[model samples]
Target: MRRPVAVAGAAAALLVALTGCSLGTADAVPGAVRVPTGPAVTPLPIPEVEPSGSAAAVTDPFRRAADGTALPVLERTPGAVFADVTQADLCGPRYSAGVRGERASDAEEAAAAYGVEDSSPYTTDHLVPISLGGSNEVSNLWPQPKEGAFAAAAKDTLEAHLRGLVCQGAVPLETARQALVQDWRAAYDTYTARPLATPSPTAAPTGGDGGVVSGGVCATDGEVVRSPEKQVRLTCRPDAEGVLRWQRRA
Candidate 1:
């Protein structure tokens, strides 16, 4: 009772499945929060709307805080690729752009050489964040320090999107999700390949003792010279004296 057509069709279907599926009105999941339409103020007051009968009722997981809210979580659907949290730069002080991993230290040095203070090495990022159904993941995210950037532009756009849906009455969670998915992909492709405004220079460190000392330098952040020696071996950080002291290696 083996069918070759079934196997071939299944293989063909797999090839077409590149991205994940978004939610829709007819396919709203349980516990989904339906957003309202209107202008979003700083306080971000929640709007009143009737809940869908079949929709699952749970605390609004996508609710953002007034100041620094945690990003929303996007669950993977049956046929879609879930948004990867590992891709986010947790160490950066702002949003997408501040990811030191995204740019090299030499790039920063080049920016400094060009008389640019705190050179911008920001990458486009999701504002509402791709996980929470914010569209144009690329468009939703903008360049700012990954650590310090807020949801200003992204929030404004999201609020407008939500308000429009709410104003029309009976906004479905799935509809919002689809809109966000479409927007993010479009924006992502647009900005991913754009050129940087400031170009990095290819110059080496200027004339100096060349980091390496005669005897050896202490491997630390900030320390003072303990013993007198021509050569010093310096490590990343020493103590808190600002000046690095040298010590012979064993």
Candidate 2:
């Protein structure tokens, strides 16, 4: 049992077994962390973007009204744009080129400028209002919203106020036109100090033929007339001063 040769062989085998175990250290450990190979990675940064309809999102610089309703076609001549609209001017019968059919076409064309489909919600409105010496030229027109603070009814009130101011010499004619064309809704709130009261559009029957002025069918029926001449057929209502002011019946 104590043979030297046998002991030497046993010791050699044990050394070989120990050398074979050196590979076990290269294996992955159960909970050990490993360093990544190649280049280190970094997270990409996020970018901020503005909303499509943000306050400054509007690209059309010319839509300048408080509610973005002031789009003009720009047809004012020096004499025409700034002219004074006296009683004589308002009394002059409207110079119409065609009929209501033509006006509907015109309204369609006007609405197209604002990218608005279905012109039913809008009326072809004047930028420099005709009441304050604005012309019928296309440049003076825009599609006015039918109801709300920026509605035609509200704009009409503003027009009446400006007209009165012009007539009273409280405001210059050019000043009123410029103010309105610049921002009518602003002028409305500033001048009126209140929101525009949009009245329910009076729906009246169309087509009546009689003397337009004296005992006209529209006048008797108290209905608004869509005259073939394309005029704003108006009726006069007396004010507290006993002076008559013309207005649309509906």
Candidate 3:
């Protein structure tokens, strides 16, 4: 709690110093955190992520979490992935009608994939947001819940800082996007200069835990939690078998 509050302040200060945006403002959604920068700090490289310790090899975008779930899993890859971007991409129309239609029609399906009963509270959000060169492909989207530790707002804070870094040319645009896509929570941890929150096998997992929990999770979770005692949260979504596997993400 103490660290993140300070993290929040530092992130806020970083954004203020770099983007000149108010301390806590996000035009898309509001929450600000500081990003690390310096005259010669190189863009952070991809950190090793152990996805599942499975037989299959995994890429940076896909890793096994502590709970042994494959992660950064996409719905499917977009036909056209965005490799180039500018600051202007953030404010444009989010998804094409076709993409929107897919999101709308599959909203419930997306929710079900996570064992959530209803898709209403979970937003059909982009895995890598459009602001940072993410595409509107189904693979790029997921049903992100609005509540819990790594709620939509929390991701927004990371996005705001990353966007600031991109706009300021402090980090390579592609690196920022790739780092987020690889493991957003890891990226958060790296940039914020914090250690991973210790996982509690007995305590429930937070949506923001950035790791999976007991009974093992379906996928590596990236939601960043404020405290270790607070369980990592996952929405009320059902697993592939249609059994509700998770609880209210807190």
Candidate 4:
């Protein structure tokens, strides 16, 4: 959360000129909406890549005890833990494995590698999700339990944030989201059994029409304003320019 939410163009001008909308239901904008469409499905073998240095090698690998050999989950830390079990399985355990779903073939490979009974409990998961721009690589993946892939919401939220950032012209939203997810996964591994405090919601922003607001998303050159009742609106005030935009939070 330290990094600013991709408030594209004129961070300063928008900060002063633009105002936040009240936390209320706005008329839904159909066309103005942009949602994440999963990562590119690439069917390629994960190359043999190590984390850079031996120090990193000793760090989080995100792998579980392979064949009961105590494979740590250090390397698998992605930027975020947004995806649920289903999403992780789609991306595979290693970031590099381009395979999705219950790869019986992968199971066979694991069975051969570990001499396990049927690879039944093992499945792939992406330390970084495709929607977030993570590459399909072995270093970025790890075979987790079928039941442990329940991090879907985290993935969804991160992906949504990335798209909003893209609309604003900040970092390639996809790339940032992927990095963030992978980072979160790594952190989760370190803190898996530890106790952490929950975060409190921040105060909501306030401003705009008696509160009946609409779409106000950011674009490359200017703002695109659409009526809340119809399409998503992007309003670029003379001063605010490209930075200010709004959409009703679901």
Task: Please report the candidate that would top lDDT against the real structure.
Answer: 2
TM-score of 1: 0.18
TM-score of each: 0.18, 0.46, 0.43, 0.28
Candidate 3, residues 8-36, lDDT tens digits: the string is 88887897889866745656545666676
Give the distance in Å from residue 42's predicted Cα in candidate 4 to where it truly belongs: 13
Winning candidate number (TM-score): 2
* Clash statistics: count for each candidate: 42, 2, 26, 61
lDDT of each residue in 1-250, candidate 4, tens digit only: 6446555435755754554433353556658877877644432222233344435334433342222222324423222322332333323333324434434564354334334455556555444545444444444444544543434333333344443344344444444443443344443333222221211212223235322243233322222345445454544221111123344333
lDDT of each: 0.32, 0.50, 0.49, 0.38
lDDT of 1 by residue, 1-250 (tens): 4699899878766755642343232455779997884222121112333343333224432222334332322221111212332222211223223222213444343333233355344433333433333333112323323343343344333433342232233344344444433343333233222221211211212113433442233333223332323434433221111122232322
Please identify which of the two predictions, 2 or 3, would achieve the higher TM-score against the true structure: 2
Comparison by TM-score, 2 against 4, better one: 2
In angstroms, give how far residue 209 of model 1 lies from its true place: 69
Query: Candidate 1 deviates by what RMSD?
Result: 23.2
Runs in model 2 with CA error above 4 Å?
Answer: 1-102, 193-250
Ranking by TM-score: 2, 3, 4, 1
Candidate 3 TM-score to native: 0.43
Off by over 4 Å in 1: 1-124, 127-155, 158-169, 184-250
RMSD of each: 23.2, 25.9, 24.1, 27.3
